[model samples]
Structures are given as C-alpha cells and as structure tokens.
Target chain A: MADRAAVPQAPELTARRRSGLPRAASPAVVLAMLAIATLAAVVLFMTLDLRGNLGYVLPRRAVKVAAMLLVAVAVGLSTLMFQTVTANRILTPSIMGFDSLYLFIQTALVFAVGGSTLATAPVVGKFAAEVLLMVLFSGLLYRWLFTGGARSLHLMLLVGIVLGTLFRGGSSLLQRLMDPSEYIILQDLFFASFNQVDPALLWASAAVVGAIAAAAWRLRHTLDVLALGRDTAVNLGVDHRRVVSWVLLMCSVLVAVSTALVGPVTFFGLLVVSLGYQLCREYSHRWLLPIVGLLGAVALIGGQLVLEQVFGFDTALSIIIEFAGGILFLFLLLKGSLK
Target chain B: MIRLSGVCKSYGTARVVDQVSAEIPSEGVTSIIGPNGAGKSTLLSLISRLQPMDAGSVAVGGLDVAATGSRELARTMAILRQENHLTMRLKVRDLVAFGRFPHSGGRPTAEDRGHIEYALEQLDLLTLADRFVDELSGGQRQRAFIAMVLAQDTGYLLLDEPLNNLDMKHSVEMMRLLRRLADELGKTVVVVIHDINFASCYSDTILAMRGGRLLHQGTPGQIMQPEVLREVYDIDIRIEEIDGNRIGVYFA
Candidate 1:
C-alpha cells in the first residue's frame, strides 16, 4: 500500500544531490583557489614595480610579506587545532589567552627593566624571551588541563577568558604607572604591525613553523578523528590523550612563533578560518588544513599589498584588517552563527 | 566474549562503579537495564575502554582492552554514546564514512563506500546522507549515528542509550535493526537501555543493575517477571504477553 509508494525511484538520489553542493567541486576548487592566491601573493610581492629604490624597498617588503604569511599560517593552523581539540566551532586559540599572556610578559618586562633598557635589549634576546615565555605559559596550562581529565573544555575556556582579563588588567595598571616614553615602546608590541618585524627572528620562526607543520602533517589523519569528539574518537582507535597533547603542543609552538613574529592579531585567524570552511566543504584535514593555511597567507599578503599599492601606505594594514575582522566576529556572534 | 573482572571506577572518593564483575555473552543483544545513576553507562564506558577503570581488567575477544593497541581494538569493537555534539558541520554520509577509519584509516576505498551506502540504506538515511547532521531531527540524527556505528562493521557494538531521543517509530526501527545485526550478521550487541518493554521484547538477555551493583542477569523470560522488575526499578510493572513477546507496562 503506502510502503510500495515509498519505494523511491533512482531520480531521488539526484534530487538529494541537488540540495547539497556536489562534493566533487570542494577539494579541487579549494586547492585551485589556494594555489592561485599563493602564486598571486608571491608574484605581486616580488614584482610590483615602484619608484622606491629596489635595494631598500625590495628586501624590506619581502621580509614584511614573509612575516605576514608566517603569522597567517601559524595563527590559522593554531585556531583550527584549538577548535578541533575543544570540539567547539567558536573557540579559538585566543580563547585560551595565549596572546594576552604574551602582552602581559611584554608589559611586565617594560615595567621591570624600564623602557630605555628594554629598547636597548638585543632584538634576538627579546624575541627568544617572548617565544620561550609564551610556550611555557601555554604548555603548563594545556598540559595540566589535558591530563587532569577533570576540567571540561567549557571550563577551560572560561578559565582562559578570566586569565586573559587578569593579564589585561595587570598590563593596563603597569602601563598607567610607566613613563610616557616606555608606554610608546610597549604600545608598538600591542598592535600587529608587519613593518616592525625583526629580520633576525625570521629564520628561527621559519624553522619552528616547518617543524610544527611536519609534526602536524604526520598527525593530520588523527585530527580528523579527533574532530568527532573525545569518546567517539577514542572508539575509532585514536589515542585521544596523546593526539590531543601533541596537537596542543604544536598549537603552542605555532602561537608562540606567530606572536613573536608580528605580535598578536586576535581576530585574523577567526576571519580566515571561517572563510576556509566555507571555501572547502569537505571534512578531510588534508585539504582543509592547507586551504586554511593558504587563505591566511592570502589575507595577510593580499591585504598588505593592496594597502601599499592602492592606498599608498596611508594607514597600517593591521588597523584595517583588525577593524574588518572585529566586525566579522561581532556579526558572527550577534547572528548566533559561531557555534 | 567480553569479560569484566572486578571492575571499579571512582571520582575522587566516591565510587561510581563499585567493584563490579560480569561476563557478557559473545553474541546477540544483551541489554544492561537500570534506573538512572546505576552505572550502566559507566560500565559500558569501561568495557569499551572509553574511560579507564580504577581497579579492574576488561577483555574483549580474548584481547586485554587496556593493553591492546587502540586502533587494533577499534577494528574489533565499536561504541555509540547518546550525545553527539559535533562541532564540525559534517554531512551524514561523511560522518558514516568515518566508521571505516579503523580499517581504512581515514582513506575510504571502494569497499568503504559500499559499507557506508549499506549502512545508510539500513538506517533509512539514504535520502538524508547529504544533509548536515545538525539539520536533522532528533530521531534522524540518532539514526545517522547508528548508521555510523553499523558502518564500523565490527565484531562487537556497545551502545549507550541509543534510543534516547528517538520517537516511537524510530525507536522500534532501531531495536529491529539491532536485532537484525545480531541475528543475521552475528554481531555482538551490548546496549544500555532504559525502557523495560524494549529490552524485554528485543534483547536476548537482560542484565539488571541497581545502586552500582549487578542486581540480576538471565534470559529476558527470567528477568521480565513482575517481582524482578519491582526489585530492579522499584516500580509496579505488569508483564503481559503481546504476540508471544513479554511486554512490561509500568504506567498506572
């Protein structure tokens, strides 16, 4: 009777396929777009003829572009990893307050040593100190939470937000007490600026990012499983604790590297990652991760290039990017779409 | 066969699953029935090695669950919990494809696709395979998760409250599917169930637990009696035969 009528015809599969976009287009299109974006960034950065002396402008822009790309990749990958591990779409690595901790250290250093002494401090030494301190703070927090099994991801997120507030409070108090001259130096470290990057730290950051990427590539398959959440992931043969720890460690190193490189850019990763997911519908990390990495590079490099070429460097690119990203975050939050 | 020897789990000073020991039959639907907080879910978690037991050993198919490699263990046994709060927006088909992870390790082959399709068809999710899991109704989502576990195609399936959010029709479909998996495919099915009638009608055996202890274990015929039901659930349940199936009715 009704059962016979419910026997769907072959055409139904086609109807079902129409509702969702064909999976075939996702990986290929996303990869092609990423490849094109990467190529465009490199070509534009290298061969945008300008009136400035080639000797000075060429090397300087190259370093700045490299710094932006590194920050983009590192932040993008870390945010993705954070969301995967915590199993929350809206949770970013910044929710864990790594960037605020970085700020706190910078403020404390200035407060302790005074601004004059801080400026004269070797650039290499300062960068290394920042990276080391960032890693130590994140490592201690994540390792404890991951191993304890008592703290849920929600609890960790709340704790991290509170910690961030505390750090910001401490930094603000220190800033108020510090002389105006020292405040200026510390302020430069607050907003992400590509122009102020230390060339000496570039090689070290490159090595760190490469090593983390290699580690992440090895565990990419496990990350797909990890995205299924803790219990299911464990059932599916993923060593849940070990894999989560490794991912968090890699995230820590990446965050430390990027934070040290171009300073902290809070919403940049969120902007690129949300765009990456829309660009690629597939859940496979093999495609998703790299697409995210490239999208990040494109956002930074392309945005910087446009700012320089089109706008003639009237304003810093971070201000524009931060403004746009901040608005996007608010939009996502207000629309209740970040879950 | 799955065996738990003196299994005990605790959080801080409180014993959640106190020194419980039991052996589960190797095949068919074995229902662990209990009131809330009876440690049925905890026991299932320990058996599947999802949660580490404080002081006990569990073995499935002659392999020590704690000592065996997780990937190796995954090939042999699969588990489904009630809550599936996935952060990723995965299609139903893609989520089911993950069932072959233990065998294919995230690389789906032709055989994996066949398994995924079969699972989808079995759970009546073929039409909804392309839809995001979050977009489905509660029953549809439950079926989607069951499809994922069924696609795993392991020797053993441990399900914790598979019928949690399912409606009448879907719950019956789920039970029938479990029965078929056990009867036709020879899979070992262990489920933590709350509804006594579903357990009495569909399960081959019933293991009743109360106050973190194994209250009773026997064939459904033995455990479905009025007295046993009263002892386990502290409710006046009348067992009546419906088409030769013992149906327990607990309502006034």
Candidate 2:
C-alpha cells in the first residue's frame, strides 16, 4: 500500500563501507601515522646539524622542542575544543581576543612601569601575572557574555572581535606615544621569536599546560556532545552552560600558556585542526585531541626546521604559518563549509 | 508522565509561552496542534528544558528537569526538534550511535549496538545506515534523525514537527511509527503537529494551544468538534468520522 517508487534508492551502504578506505583504517592507524610524522620531525630537528656541542646544543634544542610541543598541545586542544563548544569549524579560541588581550596587558605593563624594570623584574611575578590575567579575561568574557546558545556564541564572537580591535587599537596608540627605546622593547615582546625562549618559564608552562590537557582529556566526551549543538546536547541531558564554561576556562589556560611562551601566533591552530579533521574522520574528541595535537607538533617543528636550516633563519616561522593559515581561511570561506 | 506548572517564557516584549501548566499523561501518543505564533513549539521547548523558563518548572517522571543530572535526565527523556544542521560530517550509523551516549557514554556495547540496529530497521534505514546523513534526501535525513532519537530508548519522547520535510507516505509512516511506539512499546510520545487530521487520527490525546496558552486538552473525539476546532484555529473546519477516526476537512 505504500508508495515505494518515490524512495530515492540510497547507494548501497554495505558495498560502500566494504570498500571505504578511510573507515577501513582504524583511527588508531591514522594516529600512528601522525605519531611517525612527529618522530621524524624530532629526529630531523635534533641531528640535522651534528657539529654543535652535543651537551649544550642538544639540551637547548631539546628545550625548544619541548616548548614547541607544549604550545602545540595548548593551541591544538584549545582551538578544537573552542570550535566544539561554539559548534562551528572556522572559529578559533584566539577570536575571543585572547591574543589582543595579551598584547594589551604587555603594552600596559611597559607603558606603566617602563620596559627596563619589566625585563629585569622577577621572571616568576611577570609570568604569573600574565597567565592570571589571561584566565581572568576569559572567565569574565564567559561569565558576562557567553551563554551557551547560537545567539550567544555569535554575540560573544562579535564582542570579542570588537574588544580585540579596541585592545590592539589602544596598544598601537600607546606604542605611538611611547619613547623610541621603550617602543623597541615592546616590539620585541610583540613579535613571536622562537629563536630564544627563556628556560626558566618552560617548567611552569609545562605544569600548567599539562594540567589543562588532562582536564580537556577528562571532558572530551562532554565536548563531543556539545558539538552536536545546544538543542541536541541539552536533550541528551548535558549541562550545556557548565560544560561550556569549563571548556572556556580550559581554552583560556591553553591560550595563555602558548601566547605567554612564544608571544601570540594566530591562525596556527586553524591550520592544524582543519587538517586533523580532514585526516581523522571520527567525531569523538578522544581520538581528535591527540591527532590534532600531534599534527600541530609536526607542523611547528617541521616549519621551524625549514626556517632554521633551509632559510638560514632569515624569517620567523609564524609569518609563513600565518600566511598559509590566512589562505586556508579564505579557502574555507569561499568553500562555504563553515557553519 | 510530564507535569508543567505555571511555565512561562518571554522574548523581549512578547510572551511566547504564558504560564502554561498541564499534566500530560504517560503511555500514549499526544499531539500538540496550534496555529503559527501559538506557542506550541515554545511550550515543548520549555518542557524539554531546551530553552529555559522565565517563571516555571517542569518535572518528568517525578524528576525535576532543572535539578536532575544531565545524563540522568537524558536517560529518562529525549526531545527532537524540527531543524538540525551539523557542522561535522557524520555517517548515519555514527549519528545514531550517539543516541546510546546517554547510556553507553560514547562506548557502544553489544546492547547499544542492538538498539542501533533495531532503530535502523524500525525506520526502514538499515540499508542506508552506513550512508552519510547529509547525502540523504530531506525525508531520509528526517527518518535518520528519528531513528537516532528512537535509539535513545527513553521512556518519554518529545518531538517538534518531526514531519516537516516528509512527503505524504513518509509522514504517514512517521505517524504510524509513533502510534506503535505509544501503543505497543508503551512509551509516552509528545509531538507538535500541524496537521489536524493526522493529530486526530493517530493521537490518543490532542492538545489545542493558541496565543501562548492551552485552549483544550482532551481525547481526539472531544477535540474534533467543529466548535472546538474553530476556537483553536480561528477557522471553520468540518469533521467526519471515517473508519472510527475523526478527520477534519479544512478545504472550502
């Protein structure tokens, strides 16, 4: 009695699954490939120039590698988690103005107390202040504006962009008025330099980043549901607002550590996570977090190696990453895949 | 059983759901019918806690939706809205597997897989279970979503306009499915439906809502009268009894 003729014959799903290569290889296999890529980058970064004193140079390079990994984990996890909570693929946690916020904080410090004291001040105090402010700024934004729905997500993004513009605009104004010598000092702080990273702050950053990564891992299941949108997630009985707040807080810490380490590198997360999503076809964050983090590590280490070895340190690595990431942004926009 | 007491919601100046209070009985197919801007969807949203209430509370099966743990509430009740847009590409089977999340927490056990398989067959989607949801037609996608909710295996199911993109055959198939869910499975099915005749034919009880308040809630036979239909829709509708089901003809 039913009209069977109207049913569009869906392609034979059984046949397709049998032949699907993406599904045929388990997510673990993909992760192994990413792991191998990371190991190759590490080996190349370590022994490419074997002439330097193994004792001094290897440890220093090892420290740089570790710093890069910390940033990679922070950026990768934060961006993916942020996209999950906001239910959009194109957005990054940096859009929350954390980058500009960091800039504003540094510029304000230099503007208030002069750059010399800041450079000489106890490293612990300055580092703690920056990290704390990042946490506070993200918490304030999440509390004041981010309310766990599509309307709120858009409004938050708009407010963040506006706030970012204001922060950067204000910093620029201060820089213009600053003494020439002090402006140079502030400029040094602004341009991300992977060439020289302070060894003292590395341990603290690892502790903090490690803690946040653990927290994110614990909530990976919740993030998977949150990505399903507010309605479906709430129906599934997820405490949407609470989970979002935790995620925002975690993102704040992650972004703070990364920005604090290497200044601010925008769009790096987008490139890494976008590639992760493409490579790893699963929705569960358990598989996604590691995949994205490892991908980020490979990108950072490989790019730095090329800049140092191939290009003779003539250019900063962030510039190349930013350019490629910018192109990816435009491509994603033109493709209209982001919703 | 779902109980709503003094439930109200407002958007800016307009009160979308105004102190709506009703006790929906368990174990039957119930359809909410109303004209546009009538607060039918808003009421459902409030009850499901998808949208917060300005001044009210909803309790499902004696558990306070506001106070209950999210996973616990999810285990008790499931609600599906009309529109679903996903940012991630997902296979139909994976999407349906998410229904077991409230139970399995993303790890699918053999039992969860059984539910997923059963839901697929129930919705006539076993053949297309491996297909991507986005690749399917609108009606097939709707069925896929329905299958996901059904796989949740909750005691109570709240659906808002589940038939939005379906043609006549699929719409009838959906209604019959819900009818079986209520009659055979003894699940409490609450649906927001636009078709008055379908509401009368498939639902054991039909609730009439207009202007953010419940106008009437009764058996299909009681709500099928021309006077009640006019009060709810603001239009004259002639009703006829066919095969022991009330059918409303609104055509001139």
Candidate 3:
C-alpha cells in the first residue's frame, strides 16, 4: 500500500523537492534574515538611551554590534568545524577547554602582575596577550593529538576536561588570594556580558575574523568531505592531516577573536549551529557554512533586540541563553546523538 | 595495482601488521581472510592511507601512497571501513554523491550524477535513494556504503568487513556485485572478508593471515583445500565443489 502511492509519485515528489530547494534557498534567506535582525539590533542599541548623546551612542553601539557579530561568527564556525572533526555534534570547543585556557590566562595575569597592574593595564594589550596565549596552547594541543592517531580523540577530550578543571581551580585560588579591589577588576573581565565590550580591540578582532572567514571559505570542500569522518575523507583523496590542521588553526583564531572581544560565551555556538543544521538538512558545506554563520548572526541580533525591548534591560541575556542551551545540551546528551 | 612493501603497524607494544609485503593484482576481486586480531584490516588501512605505516611504503597505481597527493590517490582508490558514524543526517543520494567529491570537488556535474545513479541502481538502492542512511536497515546501509565506493569510479576499492551487518541475501548480492565490478569494470577490489566460502566463490585471489603474518596467498582452487584452511584457521573444514564453485563447510 505504501509503495504503490510512493512509487508512482516519486518523480513528482522529487520535482516538489526541487521546488523546495533546501540548500540553495536556506543560505540566501537566512542571510537576509540576519541582515534584518542585525539592523534591528543596531536600531535598538542606538535608541535605548542608557547614557550618552547621539554621536556617543552611535559609535559605542557600532563597536558593540561589531563585537557581537565577530563573537557569533567565530564561536559558530569553530563549533561547526569542531563537531565535524570529532564527528560528534554534542561536543563544542568550549567543552574541550579553549575557554578555560582563556580563563586561566586571565587569572594568571592578575596573579602574576599583582592585580593592580592588571586593573591599570590597557584593554587592548590584555586582549592581545590572551589571544596569543590561547592560540599557542590550542595549536600545541590539537597538533599533537591530530597528527598522532585516532585513539587519542577520547584521550584528548578527557585530558582537556581535566585541564579545564585544573584551570578553573587555579583561577579560583588566585581570585581568592588577590586583593579585594583587584579581584573586582578581574571579575569584570570574567563574566560574559556583551554590554561592556572594549572598543579599542574592535579593529584587531575584525581583521582576525575577516582573515579566518576567508581561510575557511577556501577549505569548504575539504570540510564537506571531513564530515564523513577522517578515514573516509582520507580515502576520498583529502590530505586529512593538512586540512584538519588548517581547520583547527582557523577554530583557534576564531575562538580567540570571539573570546577576546566579548569574554567567553558558552552555549551560543551550540544553539546557533544546531539551528543551522536543522535549517539546512543537506551536508554540503558550501551551503551549510553560510547558513550557520547567518543563523548565528540572526540569533545574536534577535536575542539582543528582545533583551532590550522585551526584557526592559532587567536581566542578562546570556543567562537566558545559557538556560535554554543547557536544557538542549542535556537533551542531546541523553538522547545520545554522538553514539 | 596496489603494492605494500614491508608494512608494519604497532599500537603500544603490540604489532598489528608486521612486515607484511604483497603486490595485489591490477584486476579482479582479492579477499584478505583472517581471524580477528590478524593484520588483515590493518594492512587494508595502510594501503588505503587511512593509517600511516610504521615502517614501509604502499603504492597505488605507481604513486606512493605516502608521497601522492590525497586527491590524486582518491581518484584511483576508494575505501569503506566498518562502523561508519555520521553526526549529521545525510540522505542516501547525498551520501552516494560524496563518492564524486574526489573528482568533482562537491559540485556534481551531469557526469557525476550519472555515476551516482548507476551506483544506486547497481546496489538495488534506486528505490531508497532519498531515504536517510541512518534510517535504513543494516543490510541496506551496508549496501549504500558499498554503492558510495562504486560511485567513486576508481580503479581500486578497499573494503573492511563489508558484510558485517549484511543479511544472507544481501551478502551474496554484495559479493556478486563486487565480482561484477571487477569483471565488467576492471576495478581492482581488495576486501577483508569473514566468510571463506564467500571469498572462494567470488575472489580471484585469496590472502590468508594469522597473528599479523601473511600465511598464504593463492587462487580459490589452491587455497580452498581443507588442509590449507585448517592450517590457517585452526579449524577443520570440508571443501566440496557445488555447481563449479568451491564451497567450504566448517561446521564439522
């Protein structure tokens, strides 16, 4: 009974599928949606009237918008490539300790320089130092793991979790031992609040994000095959080690830009990428990457808009996002998407 | 043709493939038969460039697998390993179309589409083309992966335990298809097979291994004897000719 209706109507269904155009239609549509959402964010931030005149508000809002977009793309693209490399959707770069390393470096700076120096340090200098530390640590860790063999994946993940815990413990210890005033200064940098983004670091982060996006676009085809798992990708003539190295490097740079711009935002990458996967069911990266990038832009801008207008600035938007993302993470874990 | 010279692979203290050297024929299906833990799969992995060799070199169609560009090697050989895990949901047609990735680089032209359709039809998956691979039955999924290898349109194909989850009907169909691929298309297929009987019926050459060592390599008539199989498998086998095909019965 099922075959009879399905068989004869298969051609029509394929035709309908063509008209649907999943991969072709989604990126362009999501891009437009992102443009609208971003425009809304720009308008909302400009008119909110928290402090400052029109000239002050315009420049400040531009910096914040640029920071948000950079973080969105960086985190989004990093998580997407990370998931592809591991062949596991539930795990993110944050889970693998990149953010923790960031926290560690920040804490170490305060601990080493005796808190007062850190408080007086320029935001641009601090951000640059943090980015450099993360890039070096991640490159060393990922390069060693990827070049070695396959069994090291689980081992690397375990090591990353332990390292993250150690970093967190170390940071907390330093935080407790530091002077109270210095601790307050450090606290400002630790919390992931988009409202207090540093304007001085904007151009640097933009350049980084731009360079990384161009590099990722060049490796798009290799990334599509990489989704099939390392072995299959290698069999298909992709230089597995080289492509993976490039992708991991891109991920590190993106993570650095995002974390440097607006502190570390956990779970945002997961939320946007998952939505992107749902929107573009096809596995081709040519469509998937743009769709994910655009969806991330939309989520950030839209969430910001809702926070300003609907919440009346009463709550931190990251808290709300984390709550929902936390629930989705649990659902995905229990449902065993990785398995 | 695929050639392995003194290939050795080790994990910790244990050697998986130890000094194994062989030149695989340029045509016909060749089956590597060995018990679990024997270096059959590891050898296949090394030749396919999925695993780096610890000591030696593998060459495919005169290009050293180590030195050759992966894209160049990809146009020549395709491999399917067991336990394919997909984090993303991919339709059968889309999965098959990936075979053309090495050649077309993700943008499938009309020629690539034809290859994809032919592969799907070859595996009796034309009806299931649009179905998700993860949603298919084990046998169906196995066939889909094999079809992906065929769609690659390479001179050589390497498969690791391809019959792992396949049913009796599908397993026989798969062997027959591989045989046809070799016979009609002149594709050189090196498969790690579990069933000796299937190997005997379908393969032009058989390579037997034990404890990471190549124990024997020969044609079906030479390798299908009870004494040879008993020595290789450590199990008594009764070989009988049925309809001009050598069938090994091992239950007794």
Q: Which run of 10 residues does model 2 chain A get worst, by summed lDDT? A: A1-10
Instruction: List the candidates ranked by DockQ, beginning with the highest.
Output: 3, 1, 2
> What docking grade applies to model 3?
medium
Worst 10 residues of 2 chain B by lDDT: B43-52
Question: In candidate 3, which residue ranges exceed 4 Å CA deviation?
Answer: A1-31, A48-52, A113-126, A146-148, A151-158, A177-181
Q: Which residue ranges in model 2 land beyond 4 Å of their true spot?
A: A1-25, A143-145, A152-158, A177-180
> Candidate 1 residues B40-112, lDDT tens each?
9999999998889989899999999999999999999999987877777889999999899999988889999
Candidate DockQ scores, in order: 0.61, 0.57, 0.66
Candidate 1's iRMSD: 0.9
Chain A of candidate 1 gets a TM-score of 0.85
Q: Which one wins on lDDT?
A: 2
Pick the winner on lDDT between candidates 1 and 3.
1
Over the stretch B145-246, how does candidate 3's per-residue lDDT look in tens digits?
Answer: 888988999999999999989888888888998899899889999999999989999999999998898888999999999888888889888989999989
Winning model by DockQ: 3
lDDT of each residue in A1-339, candidate 1, tens digit only = 887777775469777776645343668776786789788887888788655788988888789888887888899999888777767666677767878887888899889989899788887787778777777777777766764443455577678789889889999999999999899988887777888888888888888888887777777888888888888898899888888877887887788788777778777888888787777878778987888899899888888888888998899877887798888878876777544
Q: Each prediction's TM-score against the native?
A: 0.89, 0.93, 0.91
Q: Residue A243: error of model 2 in Å?
A: 0.7
